[model samples]
Target: MGRQCITEVGLWLPSLRPGVEEWQQMLSSLGQLYVQGVKVDWLALDREYSREKVALPTYPFQRQRYWVESSEGSDKTTTKHPSATASSPITELLDRGDYQQLTAMLSEKESLTAVEVVQQLIHLHQKAVAQTALRDCLYHIEWQIKPLDVASEKPSQDGQWLIIGGEVTVTQKLAEQLEQKQQSCRFVKELPQDYSELLQLVQQETELPLVGIVYLNCEEVTSHEEVLSQTETTCQSLLELLQALLQDESSNPTKVWVVTAGAVALGEHPISVAQTPLWGMGKVVSLEHPELWGGLIDLEPSKDVESQMEYLITELLNPDADDQIVYRREERYVPRLVPSSPSTSKTFKAEPTGSYLITGGLGSLGLKVANWLVQQGARHLILLSRRGLTEETEAAVAALQEAGNKVSVMSADVAEITDMERVWKQIQAEEKPLKGIIHAAGVGRLDTLEELTPEVWEAVLRPKVKGGWNLHQLSSSENLDFFVCFSSIASVWGSAGQAHYAAGNQFLDGLMHYRSSLGLPGLAINWGPWAGGGMVTAEAEEWLAQTGLETLSPELAISALEYLMSADQVQVTVSQNDWSHFKAMYALKRPRPLLDLITVAAERVEAKTEQAPNLQQRLEVVAETQRSELLRQILQEEVALVLDLPITSRPNPEVGFFDMGMDSLMAVELQKRMSKLLGVNLSSTLTFDLPNIEKLEKYIIDQHLVGFFKPETDEDQQEESFLETNLLAEIEQSSDQELEGSIDQILESIID
Candidate 1:
């Protein structure tokens, strides 16, 4: 071979050194020989293999797989090395840092060369890359609103202000503040419930062009009725007002500022979470109707009326795009997205002192989190959802329970505070104070601006915003290590159709900030489209692909979350986007300040190597003899991409995918790509049913393309032709007497 860079030298070789055990020494020696293309005798180890067998596995065959080698079968061959010698003392070895001596220590038995250590590291890095492809390499884009302090600007560009839905006292205080600044204002005690009337209120309330509309209607909630009532004020009311403002013929551009007192938590002060929905919706409105939309202003809960008014006036008149503002004391705060690095630290251990509560726990996302939580040492779990413990969810619950966890399944809505309170009481009664709350309860459908009916909007908002508030209110006193909410990327950078969803997720981000401000444990993850069964429909998923948005694998998304929980972050957006494709597509719209703050989700650009057409189409032209091989090549290419291997390094046609670092999440990913490629909805258990490329290829052709194309020769006729052509040859190896006896037995059976 010409001189070429050899970055890696080991593939199957295991490093060998002094003081190693006999079984491993033999294994490593065999591994070393195998890489050098030396074949070992397999029959020589047959007896040893037989001695190691004790019992069969209980789970389904070919389902379970992992990286670490098992020591179960090593007992037979495990023994102290006969000619081993102890290496130098570790301290002495460190002092010298001798390359050859260190190698000698690693492979005392074989005297492993220094080159082997370098080779092993390269080999291990390959394994590390494979593992990262499934875990460390996964990330999603998130928009964090980092707080920036600034001096208040003087009032300029005066216009009349519209104030809607506030108590008489607060409204009067605000109106007086506007008057002192030479600004005319009007106050509506209660916003009109009807949409047409909201149109009229905006047109009739202020005579001249309005400077801004301030809505301060969010209040503390005590029941489900109040949750809906508050959402109507914060979400529905704002929706109607923005629509009316846009439809009016001559309404001048006015910033519609939503002010909520004690609605968002910045420190540990009380939060009127009922107002939080406005923040979620405000972000959406900022995108959908930027001209008519103002920004979100969260006022602190305080009894000092004069102080509150002074700050409120200062924020309203300040000229800037500081839309997402929070006023606490004399300080003015705004949000910016800061790039974050995910941690692998062991600091985020799930404390077993208190039970974990997962709203929407029966849903797929909730269950995934619950399973991860258990793995992190959580002992007690309360899985609360509207439809709790159904046929499917019950099985998952049973599995968690069988694993020695206390899993309580409750069929109650998290949106209903009473229900959550009842669940809280039961947990407290067991002396397990709630340690963490995962507010995953959310429901939404894709709809354009016109399609976002009041009913549709409220239905979507109820679960996430109202439910999040309920969790926050009920768990205020709990000794919790984390209060995480599952937010969507739709809010971070507005989704065209999902205005309400963006709104709900926006509230989650605000809630985390509220918690952070108050010195409480909180995290809101603005997740991108997820691969595992999430809200993204097949059509939507296809669209996502075209837009260069990668669906987040469940394994990666959850692992990223566990790491982020330990991070000092109030909010983080996790999304997988091909920066090359995403930025190109996103450029169709005006540049969003939020997108500017996004660090590229991943440095690894998606490989554009899948050139295979529909399998059936490819099979139609290929000869029958070559069909199996052709399909195998195509499948192996797909599998290799998922395994993060080079295309030329196609996996063995007969080796298992799971054995090649393809976890269930990767399996899900492969199934998705294969489904799209072949135009068939493959089952999620596709990998298990057909364990290897050979089996998978055969299954695909047999099941999907059964009669789509004709074989060159009929299979049945080919078998008959074989028998006809080789009648004597078929029995040539059999003894004459045995053949005669077989004929006589057949004749006797026929006669009987």
Candidate 2:
């Protein structure tokens, strides 16, 4: 293969090979020659000269393997490799060679054999490869190409300020303004009065705390014995400022920015005093004007002012920041769509478009859902998974690209708090709201309840339940439309050995119901045995047979998802018609009859009587004594537990239990049960407050609790105590058995 090393900025890779070990030497040489030292990331190799590491892992068959016969003596010992360490620079470097070879082959008119290429590449000559090596390398590299662009810098949330020209007035004013706004800023301003004293002060105060810079006219500065006296003085002052900032714990150790008005001026004074031998020119810029620097420096701007000042500052201040971190194989490749923008090929319908988010998006269901959504004219599709993609996943991404859909893939673990937070921040930052969530990533272990440990339950439930609920909470954004929680049918119909998985999925289902009742539209897709991709295969079938349920085809499951996505609103109850049907195993708990509940209540009261004093006799005796102080303490704790809201010393109406904004779902359930027990209507409004249990108890006594259970309330007693109509009679009169069921049944029906 033909290759050449090009050192010019933005032009590193060429189509020819050089006959020298240039990796380390290039850095030293660049440090000496280039005004700005070479910028590179250990993780992402930018500038074709640096090596590339595959961002996504490859399949075993797609990677080359070399099995050499054991060498003799010390040579054999040397050949036996030590276990790979995570931080080993050698491992990182060796990995880059694969990318280098592929790029070299790609640059040439005729492809070179893997062995032939490795032999020519002196560092990798001893690395062995079998006959299928070259093909495998190409397969892996196919999805590793990310195009290079300067605009790929991380966007700042702290906001930015830019200084232009030789005037320090605007710069100083801007800094003060930003300071008032509680923003951090730094500036490079020319010192005219007491230059030496000013330098000392800048050195002392302008450390890491510097957030912006103010460039003053060089002609107004003190003179020095340099070639360009005024420019040199300005540069020297900046250097002093830079040193002071680097020294101070608060000041940043970044370059002291110098501003020029045009590209012509920038070219003449290319180097700044703040420039370091390790870091090139510290970054450079030429702007048209100063005032427009801050406002017009947006990446997706419509104006033509390049905002070179902002670009320079970003490059210099960003620690270990480089576009090269994006894994790339060849310099020629370009992404068809911009990473920041979602460009959908199909138009969305007038009706709200259902968007689905898949955690573990780089996995099977995640990828499938992404593709399926694109086909359904989804306005946007988000892949929230770990920061990895297998070789297969990358290829799948490429296929989505060919199909003309935009796909956003990010690294995150559904279970980890930090990962979930990052995902949340990414969504907020990108302004992408998720409508549905498909939690397909979960850990499962076959164990009975006795065998299941807390650690195991937490590990499984974190991703399946807690992770789902966290997403649900975060999805309170108005843009959120519906939440779809993927659960296992095993939750509804318990599996003996898979008690852990069943428990985990059951938690998900319960949360789903809770959210739905609160009026947050959602569903729990209780999946049956899954086939095709995922944790199932022919071999898996044998193990799964221990738990008797017919496995579901992956295609059919996906189709069902598609159907739901298209329907106005879908509530499906899917199960195989065999003995293993999910319905057969779901033994719904029987609801207690009204008469039965009355007996249970009487029994509970009788049990409590052993600890209680005779109220009638106690009240007559207590008329003679003040209330006990102990009663106050007990009442306080009881209030805290029952209300589950912060209590104030004074009765703050806003801090009531219902005023805490408990969702409609929780309010309804609590109201239903209390109404049935006390035979009094309970307010379902989140803001309704009951002063205390004593007040409720007194009201109940006055109303004769049983009388309040009537279908209609007496107008005279309405304000005294509220109660819902007789719920038992309403259900008893229903003609349909399904409709006659209580609140639990209604919830199940909605979910189904």
Candidate 3:
């Protein structure tokens, strides 16, 4: 047998006792064990090993029983006893201090025991390395604690297991398998206060095949007397605790176990009776002790329905599953409902009769919309501007007259009821058949609450809210054919510094709702910034070029106008081109039917999947779709006044192109597009289905929708003037102040 060293004791045994008796006993046992072919080279011991107390003397290298012969060594031999007295300076340092204090005290000393000095330094270095490793582990633990979803693997190293007794047993196993995998073992001890230290010791020994933890007994739980009763509870508690630990996101175990009473149970099992809402979960397999409190087992599901959810749960519970968990996000796919043609039409072919009234006609958008109306079919154009249409108005009027449309200019503040009444009278006396009214008068300002005043609020609200009501009053006359109001998009998305502007716009939105409820034929177009014009242009350009956000362009603005004017629609809110469907669906002030139309309109258009193959067919399609009894009657009157077309002749497609020559296919397509225009479903097949012109005419007459159409006759025009004036007066008399409070209340309800 060879002499056994205590310098490597700390590595082999988790806790190193510095008592002389323990070290001597261990040393003597290692010596006897070495005679039985055990090879011992180094030992790990603490500063307590340097204490002075012994019952025997050393013969240095004699290798006798437990004590060695010190002076009898041949040469170059050194030995250190737990009680050995030192003469060298370095030994003097270790004799008075522990490893750390010794290094600090020996910095100035030299020429000491080389082996002892080097061994102390090595142990000190190992301590530092161990401390750093432990700190790193703690740091990882803290990080995992934050999300509780992250998992980490323990260090993979050899494991050392120590049994404490009169004659203890030491076992060396693969640290990886021992610390993390399904492991089997027995112990005579219970749990301790310094549980982490115990766990750390076992973790350093060997790696477990599955997830593992170490337990220590703080003198109390370690009593052999408590081991029997606690055997089952300890095992149950341990199994429960291990199962719980396995569910921890920081450390997830693949295999589970209960090792006690000289037996090891290894398998998969559910942690508890608590049900998990996992899809396709399987049943739990029973354990042996069914009569006693039963332990839980694993559940397996056959379906893939719960795959992603189950995987997420598993990863969350055991974030330490290496690279097993992944996170990803997907975007929603929403189709855009953009129009094919974007550029405004070069010019329109028709004109409105009598004089046209356009409030805020001096503003950029007001001017543009008014100009477009003139070019379309308006013969009489009236400009009602704040500055009374200055040099710009004169130039615009000249352009209109040159284009063959008459122009009229009037001065009135749209927000003033008196001014509105004055202008209404003047128009009625001078322009007896005033046909159109365009309320483009409005104001927009940017001011925070600190800067906002009652005057500012009144100024913003007057034009859009009060002015809208007043304009409605003034325009509500029997002679007026169309009433159009201009609104802004800021009403939908409240701006930071423009609360007043938003309020004003929202007021207009409500007015639109108000009018539609009254069944008034009106249009309120909430417009986006027009291209190359208005305050929005500069702001939009600055934002896009400098910040990358977008603003509305003219094409989108004009498209909104098209929906408003062409459809005779109200509460039409504009948006950036990308939000066509969304804004039309959600942000607009139109009726429920409008949203329903915007939703299903594209679907209807798609229903007319095929188009006319040729240009002539396309023209025929348009004409046939527009053909109705009412249109035919108007055409008959117009032909008599212009060209003498044979109205009595029954139009027959079978004959040569003489009898109105409208094809059946073209007629159906025409009806589809016309239905979109009329906001009603009018079948184009009516042309072919009701081939009798007289019967078709009666159907159109009986529908009476033509009465709601454009006022064509002199009598119809007169009735409009009467109704518009009376309704305007009535609306003007009714103060809308309650509306603001109601709107706020409703909005609060929505938010709550």
**Winning model by TM-score:** 1
Q: Give the TM-score of candidate 3.
A: 0.32
Residues 1-752 of candidate 1: C-alpha lDDT, one tens digit per residue: 21245546544343555799777887778867866877665446546353543322221211223567787633321122111222224434547876566455453346557687666544333333333443323333432444443365444666787788778788888998898888887787777666456546656765667667887764566465675576666677777777766666664677778877665556457666556667666766765666666677776666544457776776677745456777676566665554456554455788777789888888879999998899788989999888777887778899999999999988888777778778878878987777899888889688766567888887887787778777777777877888999988886667767888887777777667766667788888888777657577656766776666777656557656776788766667777665544653443323344445545544332233335445565554455665665666667777987887765566898888878888644676677668766776555457766778988877776788775544546875687678767976756666756676889997787456
The local lDDT score (0 to 100) that residue 228 gets in candidate 2 is: 25
27-72: candidate 3 lDDT, tens digit per residue: 6667676677655543233334557543221111111234555755
Model 1 quality (TM-score): 0.53
lDDT of 3: 0.42
Model 2 earns a TM-score of 0.31
The reply for model 2, stretches above 4 Å from the true place, is 1-356, 543-548, 565-573, 580-752
Candidate 1 lDDT trough over 10 residues, lowest sum: 76-85
Please list the residue runs of candidate 3 whose C-alpha ends up more than 4 Å from where it truly belongs after superposition. 1-351, 537-540, 544-556, 577-752
654-673 in candidate 2: lDDT tens per residue?
34444544432333343343
Q: Rank all candidate structures by their TM-score, best first, as comma-separated numbers.
A: 1, 3, 2
Query: What is the alpha-carbon lDDT of model 2 when measured against the actual structure?
Result: 0.41
- Between candidates 1 and 2, the lDDT winner: 1
Winning candidate number (lDDT): 1
TM-score, per-candidate, Cα-based: 0.53, 0.31, 0.32
Ranking by lDDT: 1, 3, 2
